[model samples]
Target: MIHAQTLVDAHLYPNQEAVMADALRALLHDKPQLRIELAIHRYQTEDLSLAQAAHIAGVSFDRMKALLLARNIQLRLGPADADEARKEIAEMERIIARRELP
Candidate 1:
């Protein structure tokens, strides 16, 4: 934190606010989401359900399902979901290879 006198000195300058904002952005950027997540989990010590965890993370249910699948946790069990997983994998691969690229 800055000294109170420094803030008082910069009271009349718009650029001082911008400088503080840039510094804050730089500070946050240094930590990755995984680091932040682990720290939060360790401190809060709450074993939230996957859906609840996703909501806390500010992501949609579908995105959280994808994240679980990435971590090899099943969203559902049995044959139909296997077919759906194959389809999703194929679609993701196609999209990754072609849809968003030249």
Candidate 2:
């Protein structure tokens, strides 16, 4: 199999990072389930909200909720504590400032 460095050497991609990004896009396109899995993993392990996971998975918010429920994953509808609430609010503000809200 051709390595990312080989693609870079051939000038097909600007660099290894570009090659990896393209490969990831293609792989995620071909295996759409991977997108959802990745999103779910991030939501479960990271501080991401459900909406963020849905965005990453390219699914509706409700759909992501259902997927999470179907997998028996407990929902974190709102922040569990003051610090988390603050973080969530800060993230929301950042998204709004960037005009990233849908």
Error of 1 at 14 (Å): 25
What are the RMSDs of all candidates, in order?
10.7, 3.1
Worst 10 residues of 1 by lDDT: 35-44
As a whole number from 0 to 100, the lDDT of residue 31 in candidate 2 is 91
Which candidate leads in lDDT? 2
Error of 2 at 60 (Å): 0.5
Best by TM-score: 2
lDDT of 2 at 5: 99
Q: How high is the CA lDDT of each candidate model?
A: 0.53, 0.89
Q: Write the per-residue lDDT of candidate 2 for residues 40-94, one digit (tens) a residue.
A: 9999999789877887797888999999999999988988899988887887677
In model 2, residue pairs whose N, Cα or C atoms come closer than 3 Å (at least 3 residues apart or on different chains), thus clashing, are none
Each candidate's number of clashing pairs is 0, 0
